[model samples]
Target: MAGILILYATIEGHTARVAERIAKGLRDKGYRVDLHRADPAGASLDLAGYEGVIVGASVHYGRHPGHLRALLRKHRAALAARRSAFFSVSLSARHKPAAAQRYVRKFLRRAGWQPQQAQTFAGALPYSKYPAWKRLLMLAFVGLAGGDTDMSRDYEYTDWDGVDRFADAFARPLDAI
Candidate 1:
């Protein structure tokens, strides 16, 4: 079976965990998977070997990482030729679905690569991982947005079941191939 490639960019680790879950879900369905971090300085990967590809990244300050965008642009043709999907992780996905969708739209527009499937997943607020200033900034932002403001503990908003469903949907087409 041709492998599926799971490429991701994470900040604060939640997106990485999401990627891992997707990889696990695909593997459970008996698909070979190759998981790799999307690095800006790293050498380009050959997307030809994979039967399908799933790209995921988290939003910070309202944008997905620039490196991931550059990577997508660099390999846009190869990505378009294969079965592919893009998933975005953001806090807005939980509270502001339209905003999350906008982010995804803006990202794909800038990258110039539209995949077969796209989704938005809620990310976490890891207060402990942020520095003092960022933590305060995030706290204020969340407060204004009517989200979790408790700094004493972290909060995760990702819907794992939704993620599983996305993986299943993406895999079905590949299974048919």
Candidate 2:
């Protein structure tokens, strides 16, 4: 069996963590998986060897990473041809579900790629990791969203169970295909 590919683009690392969790879920199901970063600096990747692909990205400032967009555009056809899934990680998805749905739609529309499954996962706020300006900006956003404003401590809103369910569902398609 061809292995699965789990690719992600992360800004503050939450998306990377989410991707790892998804990979773990698939691995637990007895599937071989390759976890990779979607950064443009890395070597080129293709979908030829993968039975299925899972793509993930973190939303920052209401936008996903530019590299993710480019990768989606570059591989849309290959992705559409395979059993694939997409997940978006963002703080806004927890605060404002409707806007998060829009963000995902916009991303797919722009990339002209639609996967077989899609999910939205809440991301973490690592205040300690952000620079001063970003921390201040996030503080304001969190305040407006009625979220935790304690910059001294980080907050993680991702639901691990939901991630597990999504990963399992994605793997089911691989079995049928």
Candidate 3:
């Protein structure tokens, strides 16, 4: 069986958890899986050996991490050639679905990445991890969205069932490619 690669770019670690869950789900389904981070430390890696790829990233302040953008640009050809899925993690998806969809569309347009499948997953808010300024900003945003405003704890909105469904859908096309 050809291996699947799960690449992720995360800020506060939720996206990374999502990537790991996807990898584990695929592995449970009998596919070989490789989980890799797209941070600067992982810049040397490529998707040349994988039969299928799944790329995931989190959004912060309406933007994805710069390293993830570079990674996509660098491996665009290889990524486009394979059976691939791209998932975006954003708190906006949890609060406002339309805006999140627009964000994903804009991201894809800017990155020039047209994957076989794309999804938007709700992200988490790690209030404890945020600095004072960011915490205040996020609290305001969350409050405006009618979401949790508690800074003493974190909130996760990821839908695992949706992720499992996505993984299953992505896996179905691997054999054909």
lDDT of 2: 0.88
Tell me each candidate's TM-score.
Answer: 0.96, 0.95, 0.92
lDDT of 2 by residue, 1-177 (tens): 458999999877889999999998888888889999987664467888898999999888888877777778888888888888889999888989888888899998888898889899999999999999999999999999999999999899999999999998888767765
TM-score winner between candidates 1 and 2: 1
Q: List the residue pairs that clash in candidate 2.
A: none
Q: Kindly report which residue stretches of model 3 are placed more than 4 angstroms away from their true locations once superposed.
A: 175-177
Q: Ten consecutive residues with minimal summed lDDT in candidate 3? A: 39-48
Best by TM-score: 1
63-106, model 1: which lDDT tens digit per residue? 99998998899899999899999999999999899999999999
lDDT of 3 by residue, 100-172 (tens): 8887787777777899998999989889998899899999989999999989899998899999999999998
Clashing residue pairs in candidate 3 (N, C-alpha, C atoms within 3 angstroms): none
lDDT (CA) for every model shown?
0.92, 0.88, 0.86
**How much does each candidate deviate from the true structure in C-alpha RMSD?**
1.0, 1.4, 1.7
Q: Ten-residue segment with the worst summed lDDT in candidate 1?
A: 40-49
